[model samples]
Each structure stands twice: as structure tokens, then as C-alpha cells.
Target chain A: MESKNDELLEISNLETLDNYLSNMDNSKSNSYISKIPEVCKEYPCCLGIDEAGRGPVLGPMVYGISFCPVNEGSLLVELNCEDSKVLNEKKRDDIFVDICKHSNKIGWAVEVISPNKICNSMLGRSKYSLNQVSMDSAIGLIKAAINGGVKIEHIFVDTVGPADKYQAYLKNLFPKYKITVENKADSKYPIVSAASICAKVVRDHALQTWKCKEGHEYTFKEFGSGYPADPVTKKFLADNVDVVFGFPQLVRFSWSTASNILKDEAYHVEWEDIENEAPSPISNSTITSFFKMTNQKSEKPLNTFFSDRYLSRKVDL
Target chain B: MAIHIQSGKNDIQTNPKFSNNIHSMPFKIHADCDAQISKYFLQTPIEKEILSASFRGHPLLGKEIQIPAGYRGVVLHETMKPATEKEDRKFYVIHTFDKFKYWNWEKAPSKNDPLVQAMDWIDIAEALHSPVVEE
Candidate 1:
């Protein structure tokens, strides 16, 4: 336990956290886990899972899980891991540090799903929704904890979308373990609050130290809390938009706020697949064809080969 | 109007080298703008020969094509505009390329692509303009 605390203590510092995040590729999701407590492997543990930054249009959505012995649920409350929404940034960071300080009693992990990844998944051809991404992350964390030798016998998760559906799904996956899923589980359950705090602290730091893959540097104040309603975030989106590329990787391009801005500010771009999906206006009616033929000129039509490829003689360079 | 190319200062190299860095997108942008391709357009190989990349959050598949033999590609830049309609514009050779990679949105690049098919014209044009041969 002491050695685990020493290892975590080094990473608890903000500088180390920044280094850890900056070293990863900003375009993909990443996971980080603390060393499993020896006690957790020996005894049946109750694990809590929660997420943060899910609503933000900027920055990464983070899923965090915290686990301790089934009997030591009060230890989380003692560490001041209360409702993360009620806690400020400083309070969350302090709680996270305290959680790390008591590493022997608690262990946690986080999955940072990058904004670029969110946009890519949602806008992909198959169209993976945000809810699916969240569910996958939650499932991944639980699997990772179990794989890392944690004897998890009870699981609690803060709900995404409908609570009943999520609970049923998780129960199906882990039938041996008792599972509870509820709205506001972070506030109702001390273990979940600890998980929320872990997720929140990591997400806040991730936004603060975000290095744009486009080689642009920006402060948190510039993008604000990444909510679409934040004027600072809106201003940042409006100001930094490229006429061709739209926003950088920090902003979720699939979000309505970003897409709306792009529709107005950036040059119009049409993808072949998207364009082909639209309903064609031409009609097959004989009357309409007769009327169309009456207005046609007596000239030769271009070949279909050139038309299909959109090839044309260039009039100018 | 005739355009005068300043070949003395910016001579076209006989042995021109080309970089493999190239991309073709399936979307049309209605404006001319500069892009930071090297910084944002990172690519990875998804299969043995197929490459994958993304453009503005959309996935793209790419393949490289070599220029046909006995031919070279040149890039021309219009250095200066003519002061009058009758005056000739000045032009220069900026760069040359022998091969480039083309990309498609979520689709594999193939010979059926318009650009790839355009290369077939080189051989057809040679055949059309060839001198008559005596039997």
C-alpha cells in the first residue's frame, strides 16, 4: 500500500498529469489506471463508475471508476468524495489527491475519450451514437478492473440515458456481480461520488492543458467550460474556424453548435455519399418528360463517362 | 493572349524530384485556402496495402499512383499578371512531381477513379498521333 501511494503521489501533481496527457495522441481515446491495491485483490470489492465532460462540446469525455472493499464505503465519504457537481474545481482536485493519498484503501481508473474521437465516431458511416460510446467506455473500465485482479462483486454506475435499460444491460454482462444503476448515483452513493471526482479532476486538467494537434496554443479561458452556451466557447468557435477545415481537434465537429457555425461561416462542402442520399427532384411522369422535351435544344449531349467523373475542360487555371 | 514564361531565372529541371505527399478528398470546398496538411493530415495503414486518413472528421482511404513512363508532371505558377490585355503574362516552373496519392471518402481508390482513368489517355493520344508505318 505504501509503495502504491508513493507511485500515485508522483502522478497526483498537476505537472505530471499534464505531461501524461500531452504525451498521448490527442486524436484518440486513452486509458490510465492506478496500481491495484493488494487488499482489493484479496477481498470482494464494490466498484463505482461515473463519467464527466459528456455534455461539453470541447475537450474529452472521461469515464472514471473507483473501487474499495465492500465494507469500506464510508472511507469514500471520509475522504470528502461528495457530489462532484456541488464541488468546485479546487475541491475536486483536493478530493482526488486525498483519494491518491489513501491508495491502499481505494483504486481508480479513467478513460479519456478525445473530442476528435467522439466526432469521428458519431459522424462515421455507421453512426455510433454518444450513448453507445459511453456504454462501451463504462463496460471497458469494468472489464479492465476485473482483468487487473480486482475481485469486484458489486458494481454501481451513474446512468446514461435511461437508468433501467443501462442497469439491465450491465446486469446481463455481469450476472454474478450485484449491479445498481441510477440517475444522480454520484450524489446518492459515496463510492460513485469518488468516481465522479476522479473523472471531473482528470477532465478539468485535460481541458486546462489541452495542446491542439494543429499546433495552436490556447488557454482554458479562451474556450471556457466547453458548453455550447458559454459565450467564450462560442466566441472561440467563431474566431478559430477555418474556411476549409472548420474547427481544430479540440471541438466536437458533430455537435450542433459546431455544425451550425460551420454551415454559416465555413465554405460549403458536399460529400459524394451525402449528396447521393438526397431525394432527386427529377420525375418519371410522361407528362413532365414531354414538357421537358419541348424546351430542350437540338444539340448533342455530353458523354456519361465525363458526367459521371465530373470531368470538364478547364477554362482557366 | 500569349503568356511569356521566364525560363532563364526559373528553369525547368530535367531531373525533377517529387514528394509522395498527396491527397484526394471526395468533397468539394467552394473556396481556395491554405491548409496545414502536414500537421493535421496524419495517415496510418489499416491493411497491408491500404492507407487510412481523416479530413475534417471524415475517414478517407488512399492509394499512390505513378506517372506513366516517358512523361513528367510539372507545376506552373503565374508569377505576374499582364498590365494590359494585350501584354503577355509572366509564368515560371515552380515544382514537378512523378507520382501522387489519391484518396476517397471511406472508399478504396482504384483504376475506375476518374483521375486514374485519365492516365489511359496518354497511350491513346500517342496511338492517335503516331506516324503511319509501311508494311
Candidate 2:
């Protein structure tokens, strides 16, 4: 049966999320977050900025820098510096040496947002809202750089929100430094690319800490293992979640798993080992009317087949 | 040298020396250690060479940075050439420094190459965009 939450979502028009992933160039994200007077491309200081963990249902967000001088470009580039996604373990292995070997400057900031914190949020404030908070941490890193008196030429970034909102968020924090927020700053700028690697590597390690809880630890590849949709991820959740002992502290119980249990009257009856109380004062006729209304919904082709509507749910699985 | 070097302020260059004292620089992480950088004044190079991965003028300039702890990705220095000429890949490096303090790349160490070692430090100097190393 459709829950009230499902009804609210249907009316919200928030379903088809369109990020800046496909249309990249117009993305104005650079390392800096303010307006910069256009200067010669030959200028020495350049900032690259980008972010990770946007749509995942779990895990903290991250952003960082792998920047050097224009002249060091050959050496840094010799590190085969590019977006983090393009390289694999073997490739990142070779490129990382060249990147750091030629390094003149490198700095990063990591905010480890706990899954418990996400689970504790009041209804309607999904992990997306918390990820937005993590983006604020990136602004902290940038502000730290500028406060250290790092003069930057141009800032490149992979944007996450309405460009204007993100810009405003940084304005009070960084009175100086031009800001450009866009998607895929990873592919467009080398510093952002390097930052992606640092951020990715950091978050990937964090995910590993919680990989094995109660025996039967599944070794997950270094990636988005936090989301419930991952096969191994779902299995991890299935094995670790013990409602009898209260939900696993790391799992987001406000999600469908918990919601489904709450709605299943039969589960409550069997789980509590309770017999049904006397019929409600509303009478059998009224209860029948409620069932009639619900039955009508089940008759609809879209809602009837459990498998047909399964993919429509936002859960990664 | 003039290639990749820049003029940073003087106050930012005071190097903190070990007192021959037991407790020295805190193992604690500093965002960018200005004191460590101050010890080694990075005077700009007079002539430019092919870019390595370093930039002298970058605002967060620091020399105290620990080099790559190990190698994950590997590539030739010449590969930094724009991808239009050949296939591009992720940048990585092999560590020459055994005592890197912070950044962790030590996961996978590789055998060394005679050619890379034989290259003149002058070329390596130019590639990283710095002048001659005091050491």
C-alpha cells in the first residue's frame, strides 16, 4: 500500500534529479569561490576544486586539492594528472608518484559524517541534506587556504547545488577568492582532479572501517559501499541489522527498511506476539470501506505488480 | 632559478630546529608548515624546464610536505604531454624519500629504474619548477 510519504513525494516534482554530470563545461566550479578579475592565463596561481558522494544514501562528503606550479605542469602532468574516475588502482599507483614527486603544494580537509548522525535526522531531512553540510567542510578547506595567504589565480570546481546558493554559502566564509561551482571540475581542471583522488581515497578508507560488523565480513571494493543498493551492501545490511537489539547504529533506520516494518500490521502482530484487540468503535462497515479504497489502489496496473514498482523506489537497490 | 620559483614573505620562513631535545616538532598535523618551508628558501630558478608536478608560485607553497609514501599508479615523465599526442592516464609517482611524514602513498613500492635515477638532478630540478636543492 502507498504510504503518505509516497504521496507527498509524488506531488513534490523532486523525483527526476538532474545533476551537472552530463552538461559539464558550463560548470563554473574552480578551487576558489569568489569573483576574480580576469587575468592572463599565464598567471602562476591556479585553484582546482571538486566534490564526491552526492547521491549515495550513506557516507560523508569530501573535497581536496593536488595543485602545483604552471611550470611544474610537465612533472605533475607526467603524473598523468586527470579526473579520478579515469584512473584505476594500477594507474593511480603510477600517477600518484609523479603527482607528489613534483609537488610544491598540497592540502585537503575531511569531515567524517557518521551514519548514526544521518539516521538521527528528523523525517524528511534525508542524507542529501547532510551531504550539503559536508560541502560546507570543503568551504572550510578553501577558507583555510586563503587565510594561510595563498593567492590563487583561478578556482575550478565540480558544483553540487544551485550555483547561486553554493556561492552565497561561501561568500561569508571567504570574502576573497573567486568561486566557480560546477559538475565534473574533475575532468576540466588538474588540481580538482588531484583533489578528487585525495578525497576519494580518504572516504574509501572510512567505508572500510565498518565493512565487517558481526562475523562474515564481506570484503568490498574501494568505492560506494555505504549505500543500501549495493549487492554486498544489501547483504551487509541484512546480516548486521538486528531489530531485536534495536537497529544497527550505522544503518539509516528512517529509510524504507524501518518504514516498511512500521506499515506492516501483520509484522507488528506477529512480532509483538499479541492478539488483535476488540474491533474499533468505527465498526466493521467502516473498516471495509477503508479496505475498499486501498483495494482500488492495488487494482491499478502500476501499483499492483510489486516488481513493476520496485525500481521506482529511491533506494540504490 | 627563475623557472618555477616565487618571492614569498620573509616572516613565513623561520625553520624550527630540533633542540637535540627529545620532544621536537609535534607529530600533530599542521595544515601547511611555514617553519619547515622557511628553513629552505625556494629562490626562483633562472631558467625554466619541462613541468613536473610542482608549481613554485602556488599560494600554499611548502617544502615540509612528505613525498609519496609509495606508488599506486605509474607513468613516464614524458607522458605529461597533452593527451592529443597519446593516451592520457592518472598521475602517480615513486618515492625517493624514505622518511616522508604525512601523506600516505607507501601502499605499493616498486623496483627502481636506472634511467630515471641517472637523469641529471638539474633536469629533475627544472621539472619540479624549483632551483637547485640546498641538500
Candidate 3:
């Protein structure tokens, strides 16, 4: 049965969904949000940040922010914005609509980090670790809110990594705002709960409507919530994977699940040393060893022609 | 001596000091080249060495990388002959396949270039217009 949330998302249109994916360059990132709420200048606004879909192997990871006057925590509670994981999709969608209706009182935003973007960022040569990437996204959202003329005072965050470290990092970044980073701050703080709802809802919409190009065969029934642990999703991954080209664009190639799946099914060949000529002590093989040739014969310094810079010979996998 | 020899065939494989690092072609590239390279690698055959892989300038690797034939071109140092004297050339030494292979090129091999028969890097030669290694 199609849930009201899916119906509201209008995800059934494959062209619309594929167009959204096509808007961003492959391996590039983008975001989506409801209109930013106009903050009451007289009241000190409190902002809460939370992320959803961090664990899922498919779909984009979403970061959400919810903000309102510090005194208006009751507004969120009255709207039934509690721990989103416990809330039904209909209930969350209802709460999201209410939040939208009361835009002046409540402001929210969501950043959808595509699987391709995640793969690109994580696997790129510079190697911005996932944690760092998450932090950057959170920080960017906060900065955007403040820059957009929101008077943010106290910040609450739900963290997956070390809370203390995350808090310290945020504090360092925004010295003017009081920051609290804790595991499951979503349950403790109404604003965070609202953010969690926003995140979850957006993620659902994204996943439900996910599409690649026109010709590729795709059906929503095959992919579940995109969690690695889900059998349905795993089955989808296992079934849909093209050994040569890999799973469709939705799958994060950098994820061990996807890569591991490919390795298991595909006929991968790696180059290995057929014969070990020098039984040099394994400990002695450093990058410098290439330069420190024991049997020095020619005076040529091996400068531009070639440099023996690869240290792969040290450890045989 | 302008030409120096640094041989890593034995040391890289056996040295316990570098045991923690799993050295292979670090599959990272610039955003611009990523889609093209990935498309080629994923859709194409593995043994079909022509245009197997490509990369931007890397510290441990080469600058403006193209794989297999280009790798062989760098180490062997004679795989590519420039079509014109005005063409600029660059080179790099990278670790791969149990040893450091040299890679350098002035231009990618043309589709009908006689060298394409012997080397596959020519397939991607047009795609990669920049240096694989930086100074």
C-alpha cells in the first residue's frame, strides 16, 4: 500500500525524480529545504541539528535543522514532534506539514548528501573522512541559517560520534552560541526532534523517488530502506549489481558493502609478484629503499626517467 | 648522472616497516576526470588495457595519470612519440603491480595512430590533456 507520505512526495513520477538526480553533476552534492522561517527579532532563536540515513547503504544521507524561539519548545511538543524513529510516517508527515504551515514560528532545512557525493568526498585523494564531512555539512547549515538573518542563540545537536569532541568542535567554530552535542539529543530536545523528523521525511522522499537514467531497469519494490542490514535491500543490491559497471548510480561505490559485493561476484585480477628475488628483511623496505640501492652500479641518479616511489612490495596482501 | 635508478621490486613487497599500508593504485581522481575514467573502467573489459585508468597529479603516484600502456610508457620511456615538436611532455614514477612504473606522455594516442596498436593509453589520450605529474 502506498503511504500518504509517498503520495505527498509524488515519487511515482520517474521523470521528476530522475530530473532531480540529474540536476546535480554525478559525484557532486546538493541540498533541499522548505522556506527558511522568518525569526522573531525580539526572541532569541534556538536551533537544533540532526542527521538521518547515516547507516543506510543506499540513498543519500540527510542533515536537517529545526529552529524557533527558545520559549516555543512547547509548540513542538504540542505538535507531537518526538523521537522520529518511533513516529509513523503519516504522523511525521503531518507534523512536517504543521511545521510548514507555521513557518513564521518554526524554520527548518535539509541537506541531501547524494551517495555519489559521499563516495567522491570519502574516496577522493584529499580524503575528508566521513565524520569531518558530516561536521562540515552541519557547520555549513548553521552558518547559512545565521547568514540568512536568523538570530540563533543556543544550538542543540544529535551526534553519532563522540559528543564531547563534537561539542568542542562546534564550540570552537561558533564561540558566540552555546552548543550541546549528545547521543540521542533528538529525544531530549523538541527542536532536534523536529529536525530529525524533517531529515527522516526528506530521506524517505528521496529514497522513494530515487531514479537513475531513463533506460536502466528500476523498481521501488526491490530496494527497501537502503540499510545494509535489511535483507530486502541486500537482495536488491545483490540482484541489481552489474559485475562490470557495478550497481546503478544510487549505490555508493566507496561503501564496503557495495565494494565487497562486487569483489565477491566479479572476476577481479590483481598483479602480484610471481617470484621473490631479494629476500631482503621485510622491515627494511621503505620508500627510501628504492633510492638506497645496495648494488649501486651506474652514476645516473634516476631523477626524471623514473622514481621507485611505490611501497607496495612491503606488505603482500 | 641525469638518469638515476631506484628499484622497489623487492623492498615494497617484503618490508615489514610498510606493512600497515596496502599499496595499490589509489583509486582517486579529480572531479572533472572522475566520471569519464570511471565510465571507461567500469563499462570496458579488464584485459583491454587501452585506456584502463586515469588520474590527476598525485604525490605518491604520477601527474595526469593514464593506466597500463601509459604506465608502461613512463617506465619503459619510449612508448609515446609526439606527433609534433610543439607538444609538451611530462613524466611521473608511480608504485603499482609490485614495482614502480614510469608514466609520461605528450598527447594521447589518436584512434588511428599506429602506436594505439601497441599501447592502449592512446584510447584515453584525447581525454587527458593535462600533466599526470606536477613539478
Candidate 4:
């Protein structure tokens, strides 16, 4: 994933996303892991895992894994890669560059789960919840790192769901490795911090260049970090909702924010009503029945038709 | 007169609370009629109703009616008997809103015209299904 940054620099380039998303089959889950090589020769290694952009209503959620020799803790200290959320974008980029420089000593992997994929999984008929998807992504990164030949002896993860259950799940997955899953593990462990930086940097890049595959030319600046709470994002959503079609492909329609916008602002035709079946039958009008009548004995047509059928027009209570 | 019914929820099927039971909402229908034309409005904006009705009477009547972007609902057409047997029969086309869909579109009308035109009925149906459909 480290070499992948050069392509990311070209924000509009579809190839950057392609490189990051290469080799994904799409038959199983929406996420796939990309691995970077390990630099250290140590017998035992510690792996730290963390994620970024999980809460945002926009953009992809990324899970990252970082590993290094147990004794190479000083290298992470030199990079000052801790609490990526607090670091400015420039600082995070700088720390990421440093990690890339020490690529031989530090190995990392990341799983980028796109916004469209997130919406699909969350809104799927099977109801693949976001938490389950996130768990799968975190575990995927760890598995990718190990399968790529990194000697992972100890694992530390920043938690989103219940920590004990998550930790136990990981422990059962790999009984040979020591696992710790807790909140704030990114700030507490250097490897987790590095992983957090990796995830955050990758997600930032992905969002910055996000082009709605649906052909919408939207940048992250237009959406303001893809967070529902961001005023600019809220305004963007407000300004672009389509009455008939709803929103562009960029939106997660399943999210309450998007759904509410559709309910409140976009058109809402009931496509499926058992009572009102497809090719909605024409309303049965009294005028039509009158027109159908042949050879009326009355000299004049019914002038009080509207008044006579007032009760018929009233909807049944 | 046009009346707006403010419902806090969307599709009745999507939300368990909003059942299939139809509530008698506040409804007002305004009518406009002339020698060659008749227009009926049910909560649809006066301007749009008049516009579509006017278009229906134009020489380009058979061509797709120029519905303003962001508006969608039923444009019902029914044949009516003329005053005399020799007189040409009349085609009555009434433009009415599906209260919820029309008002919702009124609140937000930012869709691109060509994009909506390109979308088929299937796209609209899938979108209305409360799921994200790929283009």
C-alpha cells in the first residue's frame, strides 16, 4: 500500500483506486487487503490494527495493520505517528512518508471499504450490518499481513464494538498470537498508532479524489470530509437531492440522513401497493359511467353531476 | 387551493409505524376550464398544473408533455363523449400529484434533466424500493 501513494497524488486518476482495489473478486465481501513488505529480521513481531472513517456518512471506511520487530519500537517513536485524528493532514502525510521510508523495518496493510459497498452491505436484503462488515475488514487486514509472511507474535487493535468479544474472536482465530482489543489502542500502542495513520491517510486520499462511479464529478471538498455532522456536507446534500431520482450514486441512500432527505425533499411514489397494483388502474369516474350510458330519456344532460357525486369523491374513512 | 400534508416518514413499507391504512389528509382541489381545455389540480402547484394542461392542448400534444424538471406523478388520460355524435370526441388528461411524491419533489428540485430522462422505469422502481441501485 505504501507505493500506492504516488498514484493517489493524481486525485482524478481512476487508476489510483484501481491499484488499491486490485485483485478484489467482489463475490464475497466488499473489502480487500493490500500488503506492504516487512523490513525487520527479528524472530517475533508485534502487529497493530486500527480503522478510520467509520462514523462518516460519506467516503470509504479503511482498516489498517502495521507490524515491526518487537525491538524496533524506537523507529515508530522517530516517526511520531500517534493519534492520527489529532494530527493535521500535512503532519499525517509526513508521518506516513516516514513510515514508507522505513518500509523495510515496518510492514503494513490496509482494507478500503468504499461508500457504495458500505451502503450495499448495510442495506442488503440479508442485512449485513456495518459492525459485522467492520469486524470482517479488521480481521481481513490481520490475515493479509500474516499470509504475506509477516511474523505476527502479538496483536493490538483499536475497538469499535465490544472489546472483550472482539479480542476473544481474534484470540480464537489465531491461538499462537497474543491479542489485545481495546478502545484508544491507537494512542496507547505505537504499532496501532502507525496503523491508524495508515488507515487515516489512505482514507483521506480516497475521499479527496472520490469520483462517484455513477459518473458524478464530486470531490471531498464538496462533501466536507463525508461526515454527516459537517455543515458543508449537510448543505451539499440539501442542495443536490433529486425529487424523482433521489440523490446521485455518491450518497448512501440507506442512511437515515439520506432517507429523510428523500422523504422530506425527493419524490416518493409508492411502486408497490397490493391495493394499488402495477399499471395503476385509472380512477373509476362517475363521468365515465355517465358517458357509457346510451339513449338517455332525459332531455338535458346531468348538470348536477359534481354535486351528486360529492360523497363518492370523499375517501373512505 | 393546494394543501400540503406533512408526514414525518417515507414509504409505509419501509417504516413499520406508517402502515397501509390510508388517513384522510387535508386535500384541496382547484379547477380551471376553457372551451378546448379543462385542468384539475390536487395539491399540485397551480403553475405546474396549468403548464402541463396548457402543453396538453398545444399542437405538440402527442409529443412528450414538457413536465418541468423534478416533477413526477400521474398524467391521466380518458376519452369523453362530445356534446353531439358528429362532434369530435374529447380526450381528458388530468395532471394530479401523488400527494407525498409531489410535495417531496417540490421541497427539493435539483435533479439534472438529461440524467432523469436517461433513467428507465426500472431505475425509478428500484430507487423507490428503498435500496441503492447501481446505474
Instruction: Tell me, by TM-score, which candidate is best.
Output: 1
* Local accuracy by lDDT, each model: 0.83, 0.40, 0.63, 0.60
- Residue B132 error for model 1, in Å? 8.8
| Candidate order, TM-score descending | 1, 3, 4, 2
Candidate 4 Cα errors over 4 Å, as ranges: A1-42, A269-317, B1-135
> Fraction of true inter-chain Cα contacts (below 8 Å) kept per model?
0.58, 0.00, 0.00, 0.00
- For candidate 2 chain A, the 10 contiguous residues with the lowest summed lDDT are A11-20
lDDT of 2 by residue, A37-155 (tens): 12212345556666555444444444565444444445445556778788875565445444433333443333344444344332221223544555665766666555545566556
The numbered model that scores best in lDDT is 1
Ranking by lDDT: 1, 3, 4, 2
Residue B109 displacement (Å), model 1? 3.7
Label model 3 with its docking quality class: incorrect
TM-score of 2: 0.42
Better of 2 and 4 by DockQ: 4
Model 1 CAPRI rating: acceptable
lDDT of 1 by residue, A114-140 (tens): 998888788777779999999999999
Q: Write the per-residue lDDT of candidate 3 for residues A1-317, one digit (tens) a residue.
A: 43335334432233433445445433335664445555544578989999988888887888999899898888998998898999998888778778777877888877888776676566554566778879888998898788767788899999959999989989998999999898999999999999998888777877776656314546567798888889998998888755444665677777788888877774342322334367656565678777774775756444321232221222223
lDDT score at residue A316, model 2, on the 0-100 scale = 21
Off by over 4 Å in 2: A1-44, A70-75, A93-98, A120-128, A209-224, A244-249, A252-317, B1-135
Q: Return model 3's CA RMSD, one decimal.
A: 15.1
Q: List the residue pairs that clash in candidate 4.
A: A39-A104, A39-A105
In terms of DockQ, which candidate is strongest? 1
A221-279 in candidate 4: lDDT tens per residue?
A: 78887788899889988987655445554566667877787778854434212232356
